[model samples]
Target: MLVGEHMTSPVITVEPHATVSQARKLMQDHDIRHLPVIEHARLIGIVARSDLNWPSAAKVPPDAMPVAEVMSGNVIAVTPRTTIENAASLMLANKIGALPVVDEEEHVVGILTAADILSVFLEVMGVGSGARRIEIRLPDRPGALAPAVQCIGSLGVNIVSVVSAREQDGWRSLVLRLATDDLEPVLTALADLGVEVVSTGEGDD
Candidate 1:
């Protein structure tokens, strides 16, 4: 999915001249951890809850210190068109919890946080869907997954979701979420096709 689809819009922002005390109050009022610092309607910096707690912050009076002095000027940002995967990688590489989403004019539009990505992950994994999860290891060659899919389909089992990944040693991993809770029949069908079943369990309810 794209960042635009998941990012939180109508973002709450702070001006560079705003006091650190005001920034802290904004965070407390909105229950947010990050704030994009705006200057002349453009994104210039960003501040986080952790930034407010910096050791240097303790040396100054919050009411007298401007957020600009404590905010990170070297900000990392993303565009709405950016993919969720790429945004996630940026956060990981930078050790950041949030990213400011900007438009072509560099106007702050929205924000993406680690929480949003976690929600996407749970959705992709079919969590809380009351389905049966089956993980299998298969050969990397083409059509290797066809037999398992065909076997499950022939048995009238409805597949909810399917995820695949390449593994080491020319192996591929396939995870399937089935609508039905009865996995014994499906397991038997896959085993009959000589498929290697890695694990099976009930999906989160």
Candidate 2:
């Protein structure tokens, strides 16, 4: 997936001259942690919650200090077309929570944060999505997974996600999320194919 698909756009920004108090209030009212600072329609810096709390560096009252004083000037940003995976890598390498989406002209377009990435994680997990999830223990052989998958595919069930992991018992397990509300048919199909069903749960569990 791409950053543009998930990034929060119509970027909410604070002016470079805006006071720390204003930035804090804006973040609180909007329930956002980071605010991109803009000056003359240009991306200048970004101020985060910790920046407002670190008084030793700014050494001024929140109401008296400008956002530019506490903002991170060396902002790490991404383009709209960047993939979500690459953007996440940048965040991990930089140890930062947010990345501003910038245009070619250095104009701030949107913001990508850990919260946005988390939604994708939940989607991959199929949590609270009313999808049927199944786990099967496959033999440690090459053709094991293919037949198990073919069983579900023959039933015309759409697989939402699949992950394979080695268990402590020296067996490889395949976890699958299927885009279907009813588990009975998928379960029966897997059972007919001699696949083991580990756990099952409905939405909002």
Candidate 3:
């Protein structure tokens, strides 16, 4: 998915001249951790709840200290069209909790937080879908997954979703969410096909 599809738009922002107390209030009111610092319609910096907790912040009066003093000027931002994967990579590489989405003119359009990414992950995993989850390990080769999937399909079990990841030692891990609760039949089918069954459980209701 794209960042535009998941990012929170109409984002809240703070100006550089805004007091630290004001920024803290904004975050508290919105129940948000990060705020993009804007100035003259441009993204100037970013501030987080953690930034407000800096030791220096305790030394100064929050009402008198400007957000610019604690805000991170070296900001990393993404665009609406940026892929969610790329944006996630940027967050991981920078060890940041949020990323501001900007347009070509560097105008703040939206924001992507760790919560948003986690939501996408849960969606992809079909969590809380009330389906039966089956995890299997397959050979890391073409056509390896098809037979297992087909075996489940042949049992008249509806597949809700399929997610895979590469593992070490030339094996691929697959997590399949099946629509039915009874996984015994599906498990037997896969076992009959010599597929390695990692685990099976029911998804959250």
Local distance difference test, each candidate: 0.92, 0.86, 0.91
Alpha carbon lDDT of residue 90, candidate 3?
Answer: 97
The alpha-carbon RMSD values of the candidates against the true structure, listed in the order shown, are 2.2, 3.1, 2.2
**Top model number, TM-score:** 3
Per-residue lDDT of candidate 1, residues 1-205 (tens digit) = 9999999999999999999999999999999999999999999999999988746537778998899999999999999999999999999999999999999999999999999999988888887788888899999898887888888999898888888845878998988899886899988888888889888884454
TM-score of 3: 0.92
Error of model 2, residue 28, in angstroms: 1.4
Q: Report backbone clashes per prediction.
A: 0, 0, 0
TM-score of 1: 0.91
Task: List, residue by residue over 21-53, the lDDT tens digit for candidate 3.
Answer: 999999999999999999988999999999998
Q: After superposition, which runs of candidate 1 have C-alpha atoms over 4 Å from their true positions?
A: 54-59, 202-205
How far off is residue 98 in model 1, in Å? 0.7
TM-scores vs. true structure, each candidate: 0.91, 0.83, 0.92
Model 3, stretches more than 4 Å misplaced?
Answer: 54-59, 202-205
List, residue by residue over 133-180, the lDDT tens digit for candidate 2.
777787877787888788888888888788785565657876788887
Q: Which stretches of candidate 2 lie over 4 Å from their true place?
A: 54-59, 138-144, 164-172, 181-185, 191-196, 202-205
